[model samples]
Target: MKYFCLRLLLQSVSWNAPLRTACSSQTLELKRMKLPSTFQESSKRFVHQVPATEFVAFTRSFHGTTMGALALTSEERFHEPFELVMPGVTFVQYGSIEEAKRTIRKGKTAAVFVEPVQGEGGIYTATKDFLQALRTFCDDAGALLVFDEV
Candidate 1:
């Protein structure tokens, strides 16, 4: 399953020439493999802990993109004072999407860190509309969207 997922992710990248062919052949090889039932079950359980789609997205965004600054939807609990996290990271409690949009625009935040479903902050889940708005805002502003599942 890990190999399958890796193949899919590699295919998504716009690689040139030999790299693309290599990934395609690797993907076909993985598809031909027949794993044991026990291994399949273990793969399913592992994916449940971190969904493949989310994991791929996080890794791609973190490694593939460059960001000048980071804006978090919520406050950092572990890092007191927050500035210790980095030089350009900031936390904002924008009650509305508009406010967040405005802040990100004005502050020129290169990325926004969000948790679709908050587990530590009382199990709060972000609305689909809010997430969508953030997506649009980031797209228009040329900023990366980062999700923190952990």
Candidate 2:
């Protein structure tokens, strides 16, 4: 009776056949690559060659799907409402540090994803004060500050 019950329990659990097949066919390869110990350490040495726009799109997709909507810049390009592609993402104008602060304070933002240097968005760069203010605001609000450095 115990054996039968155990078999039934196992059968009730759903199995991912594709995942199992892929795992069985693939040979795991472990490769070592050097990475900085911390974000500060990495910032000092590394400047990603990949355009920040690419990272922005990737970030949008990731956050949009995984975490529902996101707090984004108010730039026209990012003004699209939540839909099939960008489910819950909303773009709010991040014109100034004060404006950003107000928006974040008002909303239950999961994270504030921004590019320090706007690549496609007129190549504008965030000032030191602005960046610092954002960091502080996010810290205070208990929201994540995601910098799309790429």
Candidate 3:
């Protein structure tokens, strides 16, 4: 009876075949999208009531399928159909610290999302220096740094 119940429970949880990152990575994306307000309310980073709504994403990077993730994505082929209303996002050139420096802003940008190894987007990898720069940028800008490793 226990084995039958366990099997039934497992079957009840329908898992997606494509983009299984939905289980974990998407949660990080959601947090990235919504944590600004929390930070504002708590007065942890900044005292302003208005939360920073802007986000930074890498060009040609794939985060996940959540609404914010869809917005962060650069490929039209992946998210054009859904067209879900999402938060503001700026797409910086992938692996280019120059573009990221230009895009991230203090008191406005909320977070920066990146994948160390962009497998779906042609398996490109980020350099150690590039990531280090992003860390500095986020720290100076008071924005969250989210690394999506699926």
Instruction: Find the candidate with the highest TM-score and give its number.
Output: 3
Q: Rate the local accuracy (lDDT) of all candidates.
A: 0.38, 0.37, 0.57
- Per-candidate Cα RMSD to the true structure, in Å, reads 14.7, 19.9, 12.3
- Candidate with more favorable, higher lDDT: 2 or 3: 3
Of 2 and 3, the candidate ahead on TM-score is 3
Model 3 vs. true fold: TM: 0.63
Better of 1 and 3 by TM-score: 3
Q: Let me know the TM-score candidate 2 reaches against the reference structure.
A: 0.45
List TM-scores for all candidates, in order: 0.45, 0.45, 0.63
Name the lDDT of candidate 1: 0.38
lDDT of 1 by residue, 23-128 (tens): 3322222332132222223333343433112111111111111111121223333232434433444444422576666655522554555544444435555555
What is the per-residue lDDT of model 3 for residues 1-150, given as tens digits with 9 covering 90 to 100? 000000111222223221223223222222222332232222222212336777787878876665545666778775565344654667789989888998999988877777666767476767667766887787778776665543
**Candidate 3 Cα outliers beyond 4 Å, as residue runs:** 1-50, 79-84
lDDT of candidate model 2 versus the reference? 0.37
Please report the TM-score between candidate 1 and the true structure.
0.45
Alpha-carbon runs more than 4 Å astray in model 2: 1-88
